[model samples]
Target: MTNPSSRSTVLSTSLTVFAPAKINLVLRILDRRPDGYHNLWSLMQIVQLEDELSISLSDKHSSITLQCDDSSLKTDPSNLVYRAAAAVLEHSGRVIGLDLVLAKRIPMGAGLGGGSSDAAATIIGLNQLLNLGWSREKMARVGQALGSDVPFFLFAPSAIVEGRGEKVAPVRIKGSRWVVLVNPGFPVETKWAYQQLSISRTGVRPLSDVHITLGKASALSWESVLQAAENDFEASVFKAHPTLHRVKQKLLAEGAEAALLSGSGATVFGVFRDETAARQAQSSFQTEPHLKVYAVSTTSDF
Candidate 1:
C-alpha cells in the first residue's frame, strides 16, 4: 500500500497537535543486520492516550523555543521535538521561528512510540503552520532521519512496520477496541532489550506469518488479529523482569481479551471487549502506587 496523506488543516498562527501513543499487537525480531540494527516486523496501533503539542509562529524573527509540562524532558535541540522543528525549517527553507508547548502524557521508554509520535506531530504541525504542503511521503522521508519509528506515525492509527522500521504499510482492522495500559512507573532501556535479544536468538526467521496472512486477505478481522498477536522480545524481557509477567496475568484476570507488552516494554496493554471493561480493568491497578494506568480506545489518524 502507498503512504497515506498527512491530515493537517491550515489554521491560524497557532495549532494544537495530537500525538498519540502506539501499541504493537505483534512484534518479531528477524536478525541483527550488518549495520548493527535489528530487522523487525510489527503491527502497530494508536491508542487514545496522547501527548498534546501546541505550535505557533514565534514573533522573534529567528528564535525557536519549546516548553513542556515534564521538566525531566529537555526542551533544547537535543529533544526530538526541537530537532523535528529544525528539520522542517531546513527542509522547507522557511525562515520562521516557532514556540512549541508539549503537554506530555505518554510514558517515556515504554515502547509506546511517544517520542516518535511527538516528532511526527511537529513535522505535520509545522507543515500546516508554515504552509509547506508537503505530502506524507515527503514528511515521512524527513522523519526517517530523526528515528526509525518516526516515519510510522506519518501513516499512523494502524500500519505494518518492518525492515529496521523504515518500511510501513497501512492496514485496516475490522473493528475498534478499547485498551488498558499499565505503565510500571519506570522506563525500560531499549538498548538493553536489543542486546539481550541478540544473545537469546540464534538466527533470523523467514517471512513472518502475519505478513503471509496479510498477503492473502485485504483486511484483518479482530479475532484473526488477536490470534496473530505475538512479541519476540517477551521471552527475554519477561525473563529479566518477572514483574511484567505478573502484570500481564493480572490484566487477563481482570477481564482483558488479551494482554501483551507493547514494545520491549515496562508498559503492558490489555485489549478489552468494550470501554467499560477496559476502565474496569484499569481500576484494578489503581492501588499500586508505582503504576500509571489508563483506559483508552483505538483512535484513527488525525
Candidate 2:
C-alpha cells in the first residue's frame, strides 16, 4: 500500500497533506549526552493512523493563521503546525500568507509522534504550495530543529533513526504487517520518562556495535526485526504505570506475534501478520471504554 506520509494532493492553490503516525519497533536509549539529551537508536515505522492538514495561500503577506478541529489543541505560535509554517516561511525567505487547518486523529503524548508528523507535513505542504524546490534533506534539516521525531517523518515509512533523531537511514522491510495500538487514554510526558530512566539506571552504557551493524543492512525480515524488538523505557515507564504493563499482556494473550511499548508511551502495539486477527484483537478492547484501540497496517512502500 502507498504510504500517506509520502502522498499529498494539490488542487488549485490549496494542498492537503497526510501526516502518518509512527511507532518505534526498537528503541534503545544510549548514554546520556553532555547536552542534556539522550542518544537513541530506534527502528521507526510509519503506520496508517494519520492527521490531515489543509493548506492554502492567503492574500495577506507574511501572515499565518491556523485552525484545528480538535479543541484541545492550540492553534497559536506554540503549536507545532503553526511553528512549522513560520519555519518554512523563514527558511525560504518568502513573504507569503498562509492558512492552515489541522484535523487530528492521532492521540497526543501517546508516543505516536502525531505532533511531529504534523510539523513535517506543514513543511512538506508549504514546500509544494510555494514551489520552494527544497529536497528531503533540506526539509529534514528544517524539521530537526522543531522536534527530534520531526526528521523521521520526512524519511518515512521506515527508517533507522539515531543520534537525537537527526540521523535517518531509510531501510527496506521484507513485508508489511497489521498493528493494533492500545492507548490507556492518558499521556506520558517524554521528558518525564527520560528523567525516570535516568534515576532508575546507576550508569549508562553505550549500545553495542552489533545492533548498528544489523541496522546498516540493505533490508531486514520481520522475523529478524521482531527478534531484536525492544524498548528501553518500558521497565521504568511500566513501573510508574502498571496499567500499561497489563495492556501489553492483554495484547499478547490475544495472539499477537509480539507486543511492545512504542516509545516512551502510554500506547502499546501488537504486531500481527493476519489482518483478521488484528481486527479481532481491536474488537476485544471495546469492553474497556477507557482505552483507545486502532487496528492499522504498516506501510508497504518504505
Candidate 3:
C-alpha cells in the first residue's frame, strides 16, 4: 500500500503520537533465505494497547536525546527509536535535533512489535515536526533499515507482510474485534526462537499455500479470521516453553474465540467476541501474579 504524501498542518514544534502494539494474526515462516533471514508470510494487526511518544524539535541541542520510562530499554543509538530519528535526520539532510520522550507501556521481546511501532512513530512524527514532506514510501524505506517489522508499522493497522518482512500489502478485515494479550512476565529472545525453529523445520508450509490462505482471508469476517489464524512458531515455541501453551489454554477456557502465541513469543493473545468478555478474561489472568495482561481492541483505522 502506497501512502500518498500529505503535508502536516500542525504549526507547533512538538507533538504527541500514539504508537500502538501489534499482533501477528497468522505467522508462517517460509524457507531460510541465503542471507540467513527467514522468509515469512503473516497477517499482522494493530491493537489499541499503545505507547505514547512525545517528540519535539530541539533547536538548542545539536543531537537527538531520547528518554524512556522503561530503563531496561536503552536510550542510545542501540535503541530502534533513536536509530529511526537518526535515519530521518540523515535522510532529510537536516541538522535539526530532537527530544524524544517515550512513554513505553508495551513489554519488550513479547513479539508485540512495541519497538517497531515506536520507530515508525518516530519517523512519522519527525516528518510532521520537521515538515520533511516525505511520503510514506520514503519513510518506509528508512523503516526497513531499522527492522523487519518497522516497515509493517508504516502500513498499519493491518497488512499481509512477506519477504523477510519488507514487503507489505495493506488489507482491511471487514470488522473489528477485541484482543486479550497475556505476557508471562519474561522475555523470549528472538534469535533463540529462530535457532529452535531451524532444528525442527520439519513442518514448514509451502509458500503457495500461504498465498492461498491469505487470498481467501481478504473476504472473510473477523470470526473467519480467528478460525483461520495460524502461527508457524507455535509448535516449537510451545514445546520449548510449556507455560505459554497453558496461557493459550487459559485464554480458550476463558471464552476466547481463538488463542495463539504472537510471533516468536513469551506472550499469548486471544480473540474475543467483545470488550466485556476481553476484560473478563483479563481479570481471570490477574490471579496469576506472574502474568501481565491487557484488554485491548483491534484498530483498523490508524
Candidate 4:
C-alpha cells in the first residue's frame, strides 16, 4: 500500500486518485454534543471498493468545475468534492482553476463513506498537483471541517475515529481478509439514522469496556476484531429495514466470520477468511433484484 502523503513527485498538471470506501468494524454512539452532533467511537476499515477522481489544472480560468458519471450527484459547490477543492484553493490562496471528473462506483448514502473519501482524495490530489508540501496531519485538519469521515480517509487504511471525527489514531490489523458488501439499492440518510438512534435510546449511552480495551491496542488480531464487532445503529436500523438484517443473516449462513451493517447502512458487509467464501456469499445475492453485491479484499493501501 502506497501512502499518498509521502509521495515525492514533482509538480504535475494533472493527477488521478482512487477514493476507497470504508466499513465500520465497530461503531458505538456516545453522548450528544452541544453542537447537536453525536460523539462516536468507530474502528473504520477501508475496502477495495472505490471511486475515481481525475483532476486537471487550468491557469487561464479562475473557477473550479466538476463533472460526474453519476447524474444524481451534484457537480456544483454543494458537492463535497467541489467543496474540498475550494477549501484547498482557499487555504493556499492560489489563483488557479480546477476541473474534476468523478467516476462513481460506491453507492451514495449506503454508509460506505464514498463522498467523504472523494473529498479526502481531492485534498490529496490537489496537494500533489500543486506541490503544496502539506503533511497528512495538516490535510486532515482541513478535511475535518468538510465532514466527520473526511479526516479518516486522510489517515487511512484503518483508524479509530473519535469525537465529531476530528481525532484519528491509526491502527494496523495483523492479517488481511476479504469483505463482501451487500447494498440494498436504497439509501439510508445519515440524519434519519441518527434521529432513529436518538429516539430509540432514552439517554446518552456509555462506551463499553471492550471498546476501551480495543482502543488501547496499537495492533489488533482478527480474533479480537471479530469478538468486539458490533454497531449500535443495528437495533433501530434493522427494525425499520428488516431486509438488511436478513442480508446479514444470509452472509453468516454462507460462512462469514463476522457480518454487520457498515454505518447507518442500507449496506451490510460480511468479513470472510478467503476470497472464495466471499465470492460464494456474493453469488447468493445475485438473484435478488434490489441488491448490489461486491466481493473485495480489505486493503491498507490508499
Candidate 5:
C-alpha cells in the first residue's frame, strides 16, 4: 500500500469513465459446470445507452466508494465495482485508494451486463489514469476473471462471444439502428436461468436467426443466418413469466425483425427495421404499467 496524497506518489491517478450496458442478441447455455456455472455462447452487442462512472485519486491504499440511485444493490465489497478495483490491484501491484462515483441508469440484475461493464470500465479507466500503459489484451485478461460478459467489453464492439463468454470474435455489423429493450419490472437471476436449461430432457438447441433491414454491409446481412442463431434460455424464462413471453410476441407483432430474450432475461429486446419503428414500439409499451422500455441504437464505444 502506498500513500496517494503525496505528489511524489507513483500510482496516484484520476479519471472519469462511462460504463455502458450490453444486450445479448442471443444466449445459449451449452452445458452445466461443476463450478456451478453454465458454459454459454452468445451474440453480444453494445448499445448507446450507458451508466457513468467517476473515479479520482484518493489518499488510502485501495479504498473504494460507490454511490448509486438503486438502494437495493450493495455498494460494499459485494459490488463488482469493489471487486474490480481489487482485481486491478492484485495484478498491477499498485495499491492506491480510489474515489469512485456510480451514476446508475442501467437497471441492476436486469441481465444487461451493467455491473460487469462497470467493472471493466474501472479496470480500463484506472489503467490509463495510473499510466500503467496496459494494452487491450491485458485488460481483457483481467475482465475475464471479473465476469463472463466483461471480456467482451474489452474488445471491439459487435463481437460473437463463445465459450463461458470469455472468447470474443469481432464481427462487423454496422448501422446505429434501433432496438427495443424491455425489462418487465423484474430482475432475472442468471443462476436460476441456467438451472432452467434442461438440455437432456428438452433435447433441443435454440437456433440462430439473422434478419437484414438496412445497413452498410447489405449483401451479407441476410435474414436466414440471423434467424438461425437462438437463445436456449428463452423458453424456460418465458415459461416462468407468461407476461414476458407475451411482450416478445407483441414486439414481433409490431414488426420487429427479431424478438428474443436478452442474456438470461426478464429483459427482452426486439430488433427493429429502424429507429422510428423502435420508438413507436416503445410508445406502445408505455401503456403497460409493469414494462420499462428503452429505445437504443447499437454502439460499442464506451
Candidate 6:
C-alpha cells in the first residue's frame, strides 16, 4: 500500500509548462478523404517565442484560471486548455480537480499553433502529475484528437509531418535562420483560408501535399530557396486579402533572405541569415500601424 505521506506530496505539487510556437515552411493540401480531413504535408519548425502555462491542484476542487495580455478570450471550459485538462483527468480516473492557469503570449488565430501548443503542454503536465507514463507516441495519439498541430508538440523537434498531421519524422533542415514575425492585428482562420481555395492554373487548391522534393535541403542558398519556397494555399489566401500579399512582399523588400506566409496567416515571417538583417527588418516595420512585429529564430526542431 502507498504511504499517506507520499500521497499528500503528490496532491500538493504543481508544475509550470512552456509551450512554443510553430511555423510551417510549406503547407500543401492533398486530396480530401471521406473522413472530412484534407490530407496535408508540412515542413514545420519551432520558434523561441512561447506561451507559459502554470498549473496546480485546487484545494477546494477542480479549478482553472487563465490570464493573458489579451482580455478577449474566455479563460474557461470552452478554452482548449479546459478540454485538455478534462480529457487527461478523466482518462487517468483521477477525481482530483485541477487549477489550470494559462498565460497566453503567442498570438491567437495567427496560424502559430498557440492554442494547440497550450493543449499539448497541459497533457504533458497532467501526464507527469497523474503518473500516466505515456510514451511520446501515445501522448501524440491523444493530442491529435485535440488538434492537428497538437501532435507536433508531443514529439517536439522539427518534423516533417504528413497524413492529417499524425505521421511525423525527424528532419534535418539546417541553419538557425533569424525570423521576423508580423501579425497584422488581424486573425485568419485556417478553415476560412481553406474554404477560399479553388482550383486554379497554378494548382491554387493544392491538390497534393507538400513535397520536400529535394532531400537533405541544407546546402541551398537563401535566394534560391526563396524562389522555391512554396505555399500552395498562398495564391488563394493572398488573393482574398491583398494586404497579406503585400506583407509577403514587404518582408522581402526589407531584405529577408526568404519571406513566406506562416501557415494560413494574417501573420507573415521573414527569414534572415544574420541578426543584423533581422533587427533591421524589425526596425523597418516600426511605422506600420496595423502590424505587430516580433523577432524570432528557427528552432532546432518543430
How do the residues 1-302 of candidate 6 rate in per-residue lDDT, one tens digit apiece?
01000011234378877788888776777777799877887777777778877778776865555555558877777788888888787777777767766667888888888888888888887787767887777777878888898887766546667888898665555557888998888888888777776454334354332145532453333344445566767877788789888888988998887778888887788888878899999999898877888888764643
Local distance difference test, each candidate? 0.85, 0.89, 0.85, 0.89, 0.72, 0.73
Model 3: which ten-residue window has the lowest total lDDT? 1-10
Stronger candidate by TM-score (3 vs 4): 4
Q: List TM-scores for all candidates, in order.
A: 0.94, 0.96, 0.94, 0.96, 0.86, 0.86
Per-residue lDDT, model 3, residue 67, is 96
lDDT of 4 at 272: 98
Task: Give a tens-digit lDDT track for model 1, residues 1-302.
Answer: 34332333345889988888899998888867899898888888888888989888877768789999999999999999999999999988888778889999999989999999999999988887777889888998999999999988988778889888899888877788999999988888999998888888887678666667863565777787787888888888999988899999999999877899999898999999898898888888878979899999884544
lDDT of 2 by residue, 196-259 (tens): 9989988876665757765889688888888778898999999999999998999999999888
Q: How much lDDT does candidate 3 score?
A: 0.85
Give the residue spans of candidate 2 off by over 4 A.
Answer: 1-4, 208-210
In terms of TM-score, which candidate is stronger, 2 or 3? 2
Q: Say what the RMSD of model 5 is.
A: 6.3
RMSD each, Å:
2.0, 1.7, 2.4, 1.9, 6.3, 5.9
Task: Name model 3 segments beyond 4 Å from true.
Answer: 1-11, 208-213, 216-219
Q: What tens digits encode model 4's per-residue C-alpha lDDT throughout 74-165?
A: 89889999999999999999988888999999999999999999999999988888889998889998899999999988888888889999
Candidate 5 per-residue lDDT over residues 1-302, each given as its tens digit: 01110011124355667766777765666656687666666667777667777777787655767776678878898788888888888899976777777778888778888988888888877777777788777887988887888877776466667778777765555555578889988888987876676732465443323312211232224253256446777778888888888998999889888888888887888888788999999998877877788999764343
Candidate 1 regions off by >4 Å? 1-10
| Consecutive 10-residue window with the lowest summed lDDT within model 6 | 1-10
